[model samples]
Target: MRRTITKFGSLAAVSMFALALAQPAQAVQAAGATGTTAASSSAFFEFTDGTDTFVFKLTDSAKIQQARNILSGVETENVGVMGKVVKTPAWYNSPWKYQIAPNSVSFFGMAMEVCDASISYVDTHLNEVGGALLPGSTWCPWQSKLTREVTAP
Candidate 1:
């Protein structure tokens, strides 16, 4: 009788331990099924055109910082004229001025390209004159761009 009682007590203790370990996993699974596994957020912004908009979805704060850095010129490419064949700077890699809003970010800048005498001439002669060819100057039309950040709801 004594041995039997001891065996039963051991089994009960093991069962309780197993139950305790399983509880957290069950709770996690339940939360995942309900789509509440993690916190989510999003941001949105519009271009200078005002009609165009962009959105970004971020899973963590690191992504938000990356977007900020990109806009802040931390990783901006140099201002240069685009060239044919070699494929001068297009839209994405160009330097842009970014603005952070309550729920979004806005980016605006001009894209430089090596055009025929028409575009370059207007830029150099009329716009530049003696001064340097400043980027996004009167010679360069507003590229008009925007970007936004988003995350799971």
Candidate 2:
């Protein structure tokens, strides 16, 4: 079930208030997590305009970081462009948060914020991620995480 927090509480309710605030924060990380499975093992991002598609295959953390820098305007050069992944979406990934690079992603050669619908779709497909991201490592932003999906026991 969903939860919420309330305000205007008396001193006697300090502990309860704290707990309420903490609950939502703790749950946010898992908000859209439907679970994960090892569908793909590489890191990549895909963009499509329905008729045509583009793929940017990322080899290592540096390239991924470069892309992030480009989005944040930290890097003046577009050195983040790695090898072309493919003309059509063709990877399979699990449904989970793969820690996408920070900043608005690309679409049809335009720079704009990625829609939640795209994030959700790509996250689940990873393999055929229609648009958005492929499987991303946790080690991003300066480190890495295994891009493999988590399976239920």
Candidate 3:
């Protein structure tokens, strides 16, 4: 059961979305200019599906700020492109060995993680992520939101 997704307004209305997906390399460089290592500058974002809280890391300074803005109510874009879920050590505080593609972070008004599929479906079908589940390896939790900014462990 998919709900009706809302479309974002013109470009002027969602400037943060554009900024979030901006050049990540440039953002890392900007952080370096300010005396911070790429890893030290990484920001953590927390999203919730009402029952569960998911944490993610954004290495891009621009995306970090954009995520902070979204959580602070400055940006209304509540959806993000989750990219690929890596089978590495969990970047977030989850027991599952999954982490979203940091370089692929971006905001969207409406997105389907794997063409109208739910996150649970993807998790249950993680083995087929890059194959059938998420052919392109992107997971956009449509109902997810930037609930908070957290400190990395």
Candidate 4:
């Protein structure tokens, strides 16, 4: 009787261990080829000046890196407008041109949105300011307007 009981207990323990080992493999098989990949995220920003609207989509890491590189060199320039020279500061230049305001980064998965303030030079005399140019006076110093973040789908 004692021998029989010992054999039964050993068999039970072995069966439990085998069952535990089989579960993970079964799960992996159920997941299949599509289930093993990781999720992707993206980031972007939108701007409106009560007239026109602009949206920037940062969908890739390269784009994010490029934006960061562009923000590092911020400066001003003088451009000709209707035969007249005008001093205009270029926002989003090399450095500090892309101003990431404090506490503006919002994360959604691997993506994040960072509040930023940027500007571009324009020739007002020609009535042709390239792109969606926002005047410096429109945004308040304390108010946060820019959104830079990653998004996921």
Query: Which order, best to worst by lDDT?
Result: 3, 1, 2, 4
Off by over 4 Å in 3: 1-40, 113-117
Best by lDDT: 3
| Cα shift from native, residue 72, model 3 (Å) | 0.9
Candidate 2 accuracy as lDDT: 0.36
lDDT of each: 0.38, 0.36, 0.68, 0.34
What tens digits encode model 2's per-residue C-alpha lDDT throughout 21-72?
A: 9987666546537453222223455433333233334434554555555555
- TM-score of every model versus the real structure: 0.26, 0.25, 0.67, 0.25
Off by over 4 Å in 1: 38-153
Task: Tell me the spans in candidate 2 whose CA falls farther than 4 Å from its real position.
Answer: 1-42, 47-53, 79-89, 92-153
RMSD for each of the candidates: 19.0, 17.5, 12.4, 20.0
Error of 3 at 137 (Å): 0.7
Itemize residue pairs with steric clashes in candidate 3. Answer: none
Q: Highest TM-score, which number?
A: 3
Worst 10-residue stretch by lDDT in candidate 3?
A: 1-10
* Candidate 3: residue 113 Cα off by (Å): 6.2
Report the lDDT tens digits of candidate 1 across residue range 77-133.
422112211112213322322112222222223454422123334322543422454
